[model samples]
Target: MEFLIAPIIVALLASALALTISILDKHVNNYGDVEININKGKKVLDVKGGDKLLTTLSSEGVFLPSGCGGRGSCGACKCKISTDIGPVLPTEKPYLSIEEINNNTRLACQIKVKKNLDVYIPEELFNAREFSGIVEEINDLTYDIKEVIVSIGDESIDFVSGRYIQLVVPPYGKIKESTQRAYSISSKPSERNKVAMLIRLVPDGIATTWVHKYMKVGDKLRLIGPFGEFEKSDCESVMICIAGGSGMAPFKSIFHDMLEKGEIDREVWYFFGARTTKDLFLLKEFQEMEKKWPNFHFIPALSDCSPDENWDGEQGLITDVLDKYLKSKITPSKHKEGFLCGSPGMIGACINVLNDNGIKDIFYDNFA
Candidate 1:
């Protein structure tokens, strides 16, 4: 009788708490539709409130530049806010600079669509669109690297020569959600109906392993945009491009564009680095181009050259080779711009070398 009475008392208390929570949620969680004004009301969207601004804008066919979808991690979806949406959250603070914060910049993925909000976005982002294509070809450049050529029908892939595209990888194996990986477009910009991407196999990587093992040549693909601002500058500076692994993608596109437009006489020095002789590719193509275009110089270097290979070219670490070229081969007074693409460690090291050599205007394809 005592045990029965105690059980009854606990059940009654639990029921009362559940009822109170239900009542509170009914009133507290309901937020009606909100209006979003973009670029001073030039574009407006009336979307359901309480969702993140990044998702709401994407639903309205307005694709904002977000690398991690709406996860609030990439910090690529920064937008200027005219009206006070809310105080800046902790998630967005690390990404935003002091100047950006003063300019009222906020991460769209973190800001919830609560009421009428005025946001300013870049005009160029409005031009970026989704592209559906079929993988026409996959050519192996190295044992771990493959080049995927996509045919986009009549849809144009209008982009600057050095910009990158996001590959939308569908869920595979245990990956429950799709993810987007950025790859620099290795194809020529003059060929508007086709896109080429160079991908390297990463160990147990979600996207790379799927591409290497699962993706077929004729499979359909959904990709987005020509993101990043790493294109060649218009200044009359000598171009010094350094790339290793799949980082060779964007520079290939740029050089082709230069050749097609007869702008090959730009005094360019392309340094391609690899661990061994077998890791090197595109030597014959670039060497042929070097013969055709007097201004283009192809410099292929190997860090671990075998004795049997008898490599006569630059044989040292890429940074050491670059340092040698800067001091002895390249003119010291000429204004030079450094183009680097690789992992963060490689890029940072290259930046330091370029800065040390007085090549101040350096650029890299930082595709987040």
Candidate 2:
């Protein structure tokens, strides 16, 4: 009991010290107004200093893509700071490449706005806005995957298919602060007043927990979006799209948008992988799509499916199925491009398979 008490006292002291530092930083360290020059004068913000760059920008109506809600975990809130804001922090090193470090790219969430700074961001970010939405629908795509639809009354968002939006989860239960997470818009771009996201529950994940457990119909929500550069090419090359689980979101939007716009001339082969039939979703939806769009094909494979189950689709690792199709099923004469979205390991495996099939051009979004 005495040993446990010693550790408890140490933890208490550490917590007190942390709280004291936070209060001192918040109340004592006032850096006054700081000017943020964005995109070489395309936009300028005069904000209170001594706050995180991300919070400062958001308060000024500038929203950067922060999958972890400015917690310095997602590393998605990266921007080029041409001015010297000090060296890259240790928390940011794991996410940034050496080239990015050399270019002075820094995580906005980890940087403190101590003074005037020049930052370069994509012009499209200027169009991203915070939207007020009400939960309209929530359907379980699978045991783990959910289709969440939000209705944005009156106001509409204009975004290309395959882009993602950040869903803001307000504080609830034991959580003391709100958080935002990025989710690809599965709804078609033409449905401007509604947004749908396929969310896969991650154990103990702040945003996913709130989405799966706390979110309910008629609940008000905030979404900041139109971020991400994932989109279909206008070229005529056959598109070989591959995904697993919630990775299907972007492709769903892209295909629906293409179909709606009468751009089905391009051939597309979508390969969806899962461990079992129970893990798969949208079989009927994609099957109907395949029937309606002759040029589109949907191949769902299960690697570890039980023999007792009535499974008749491809059975093997996703890479193996992809390779098999590339060798025999797909036309060798036609130029092909690969679009992948999934875990880093899955994306790397698919890339190798695609490259071995004499395909070089590849684009991917890694859910890391």
Q: Against the unseen true structure, what C-alpha lDDT does each candidate score?
A: 0.86, 0.93
Pairs of colliding residues, candidate 1: none
Tens-place lDDT digits, model 1, residues 1-368:
99899999999999899679757754688679788999987898888887778778877877777666556767888999989866789989998999999999999988877788999999988877789999999999999999999999989988998887878889988988887777899999888999999999989877788899999989999888877777888877899999998989999999989898888668999988898988888889899999878989888899998889978888988888898898999988889999998777778887899999987888886534
Error of 2 at 281 (Å): 0.9
Q: Write the per-residue lDDT of candidate 2 for residues 1-368, one digit (tens) a residue.
A: 99989999999999899789978998998899899999999999988888889889988889899877887877899899999988788999998999999999999998989999999988889899999999999999899999999999998999999999999989999999888889999999899999999999999988899989999999999999889998988899999999999999999999999989988788999999999998999999999999889999999999999989889999999999999999999999999999999888999999999999999999997785
Query: What TM-score would each prediction reach against the true structure?
Result: 0.88, 0.94
Candidate closest to the true structure, highest lDDT: 2
Residue 278 local lDDT, model 1: 84
lDDT of 1: 0.86
